[model samples]
Target: MSYAPQKRHSNRAKRWIITIGVFIVVQIIFIAIDGTFLEPSINDSDNVLAKTVRGVLESKLLTERIAPYSFPFFNLFLIVHVVAILIQALGDSISAIFAKR
Candidate 1:
């Protein structure tokens, strides 16, 4: 029922909002940098590996590969790259939700 606690809570919420905003902005900048710079620098072997993975996906061989545990090294690298991106996105989303509260 006290107004002082309410005011403090409001200020804390604003600070969180600003922090999450900054985080999302930085993430967007980094994503742009990666897309524009890092993505193109991948070599021919990487290209081949990506193509092979795509072929496996199109052929519905991923399930079989999963069972055999014969994941190509390049495919594992790609999975790690994708998982890192997912983690970043998930962290940003969670921060935004908590900031909204």
Candidate 2:
């Protein structure tokens, strides 16, 4: 059996590391922006739709009597966003594994 060169193997490994690092950074930024800004604005009551939506959200059993403007939508958005991110991460990981081969 022939021995594989270590340098080439390490270089290929470095590419995967960089790819994973970039993926993580991008995900963090996406989560931060969604959590910090987009979600709050979506749930804000500057418009009638937002107020109606907030009222409906406040009537839920889990958040009964909670303030309508207290960012309740943040939790809902967070859960959905996290699930979506997980699915996307799973797909990316599978694709990366296949690509490495």
Candidate 3:
């Protein structure tokens, strides 16, 4: 008769919200740092990884049109976030399949 289960579910949802908010804030900070300091210095560098990253940034279609002032690292963060979501979904699906047995 207790509402403990409902309360626990609500708590879990709140935790997820807070965690996601923190993740977004961290990404914003990363983008700022990369744009304000890292990218400018690396722009003229001969590093292969930096060149690859610059190429990837140049290849973004929607991001550039949507936000002209967006940082280069913003696209990278989005890609990473999407991949993380996909991996989490896959893990959840595998766990569900195993749980059914």
Candidate 4:
């Protein structure tokens, strides 16, 4: 039996591991920023970033009436997840291009 299938599977698994690791790291960073800056600014009526964040959260998948406290966190998670996937794809593409050399 050939080992090509096993190698391919290993590579795919590595890619998933890298992606998930990146996602977790980035999510932690976002949470830190939220706790340090956004959470405090959220109560300040003069804070533009807070206002924009609230507007985006409310306009996208939630409304003020039904919006749970976790909605903003969910939004941040979605954004980070997509960004991690994109980073993984981009890294794979770059590696493949260089591998042809």
Candidate 5:
């Protein structure tokens, strides 16, 4: 019954989209710089997820020769952030879809 609350929530989601857009633009700039001027590579990543992945790989029986590749940490960070933002937008969109019924 309270439509005002829904309106406020819409504005919040819109703000989130805008913020994410800005971040995406910044990421594009960084990627451009990285590609055009410098060599981008993560030689030693301290990320917990990456460490876990390495652990799993090492634990596997036939993964001896299949070395753990260098994780593109910065690229992964950019990608995961973008994906998280999209996921938030997706959840909001899904909620709107159900309300339409």
Candidate 6:
């Protein structure tokens, strides 16, 4: 109930938020590069991964709806950032459990 622990938690939360922001920025940079170069070649491959990705890209939910607003990267970043946050949260929880014991 003391203010000290609450302040410490806020600081920790801020640091994690900043870390996730940086991670997402880096991910977007990589996305830009891949979208410019590698994405163009995805359709030409015969691998399962390629096929899966292509299928997702071509799905009506994306092709007919999301694509209309030019929100592909928007969706991509949203999902990526959520995953990054989840991963960090998972790691933090695991560490906290071990530290408690």
lDDT by residue for model 6 (24-92), tens: 686676557643544433355898987787677666766566442243544454556667789878987
- Across residues 1-101, which tens digit of lDDT does each residue of candidate 4 receive? 77775786588789789878877786676556653435533353768987887677667554444333344655555665687688878886786676532
Off by over 4 Å in 4: 38-101
Question: After best superposition, candidate 5 residue 5: deviation in angstroms?
Answer: 6.7
Q: What tens-digit string does per-residue lDDT give for candidate 1 at 5-79?
A: 567668767865775676567556554554343443433355878777556644443435432223333334444
Task: Name the regions of candidate 5 deviating beyond 4 angstroms.
Answer: 1-6, 9-13, 32-71
lDDT of 6: 0.63
Top candidate (TM-score): 3
* Tens digit per residue, CA lDDT, model 2, 23-96: 56855655565435464344475999888877765656326443223355544444455566577668757755
Candidates 1 and 4 compared by lDDT, better number = 4
What residue pairs clash in candidate 3, if any at all?
none
Number of colliding residue pairs in model 5 = 0
**lDDT (10s digit) by residue, model 5, range 1-101:** 76876786788778887877888697666666654436454334898976775565444332433222222434445556667878877987887677653
Error of 2 at 16 (Å): 12
What is the clash tally of candidate 1?
A: 0
Model 3 lDDT-worst window of ten: 60-69
Backbone clashes under 3 angstroms, per model: 0, 0, 0, 0, 0, 0
lDDT: worst 10-residue window of model 5: 62-71
Residue 34 lDDT (model 2): 48
| Candidate 3 segments exceeding 4 Å error | 1-21, 27-43, 62-69
The TM-score obtained by model 4 is 0.47
